[model samples]
Target: MPIRTEAWPQGTPCWIDCQVDDPAKAGEFYAELFGWEIQDGGPESGGYLMAAKSGAAAAGIGPKPEPMAGSPSVWTTYFAVDDADASAEAVARAGGRLVVPAFDVMEFGRMFVAADPTGAVFAVWQARGHNGAAWYSEHGGYVWNELHTHDFDAAKKFYRDIFGYTYTDFDLGDEKYVTFTPPARTESVGGISDDSAARGEPAAYWLTWFQFDDVDAGAKRATELGGTVLQPPTDSPVGRSTLITAPQGEVFGIIDPSKRVGEMPAPTS
Candidate 1:
């Protein structure tokens, strides 16, 4: 288990949460699907529910605020920041716009939401009393996050300026994809994929990937739970995966990392 007692490295994805119409219903859906124990944050927090895996924080399900009522439910990814105030300033300097100005979350932390130049919405968190996720990169927790954008180069430039990210390019055999490394880190934190010519011209958004023990079974369970399977289970370089929309209409990805194919197998195996 990869557990964290403190905060994630600066610029890495630190947390994810979905804003939906009915959080209680959405909480039940996730609890059944991921074997999570949902705990409420009470009235002070607007009934935000924390989904925990093995007694550790994994994700969140919160109700959409008044301004966003009836809007499409979606998962939002948050990046770790040393200072939310500083990050907001950098977002402006880098040509990104702050959707929500820096604000304190009681004693838990400070956070702000922003949109990249490509129109992708994301947030930055400066942890105080509450570190983000207690565990990740495991079943029932987040494994990866990627940005799907129309202007890939513009997206990369904006984030690089904000986080001092360095790029690792992949041909992908279609358009190009690149994974970005935060300053002073060897491991890539997340990916940026170009799909300017995609069939639908999908709006830019951050896609959060959660690990499942069995990808196919997970997809089956999701459908049984009133969710729709957007993409059937497929083997990719990342893992055996599927794209799904929850009952409340939040889009997310599922993968079983142990089922790797091609040349990416574990060394011991």
Candidate 2:
């Protein structure tokens, strides 16, 4: 389990947090769907609710951004880094746009928001008192992160330069996708491919896959929990999967890979 510890390459993915319109409702929705325990994260933290599993941190649920007043809900993913400033700089150098400048969060960590070269948004974190989500892929935690973009080559090059991600192409016969491997031999972090090629969809964005013990069971639970099935459960050469949209309409997927879930998977970019 050589998961990248808190002290790894300057910028690594250590956590993911999302902002929702109704924190209480989001909490209720996730608690019912993922069996997560949602509780008040305290006043200093803007009364944010921390989603935990078995008392361990998994992800986060916070109030949605102001600009998103009436828009559907969405989850913002955060990557761990040694220095948020440095990572932001890399993003700029890679042709990505910085949505927000790095700022401190009391004593928890430093963070900022940015979009990839393809316009998909995400966050970067530099932990101080707070490192990241305590729980991971195995049970209701994030299992994988992937990028579906318009330009595969440009997106791939940008991430490689920014996150030091190594690329490998996985041929899925009729169609193919690329996997982003991190610095070590551990589980690969996420994957990427041309959004148009992968699903024939025009919108380009990054996708995160939450790992489940049972793909079919998770799919059923997703529908029962007020989510819509974007793609029904199906198995591919890499793994078994199903795509679903949250109550607010943000899209993501669930995976039950052929290989058993191992330690922390590396980031794709």
How would you encode candidate 1's per-residue C-alpha lDDT over 197-239 as one tens digit per residue?
Answer: 7878566889999999999999999999999999999997678
Say which candidate scores most in lDDT: 1
Model 2 C-alpha lDDT per residue in residues 60-105, reported as the tens digit of each score: 8888655446755667778778788988899998898887788998
Clashing pairs in 2: 10-82, 12-80, 13-80, 14-80, 189-266
Per-candidate clashes come to: 0, 5
The global Cα lDDT (0 to 1) of model 1 is 0.89
Query: What are the lDDT scores of the predictions, listed in order?
Result: 0.89, 0.74
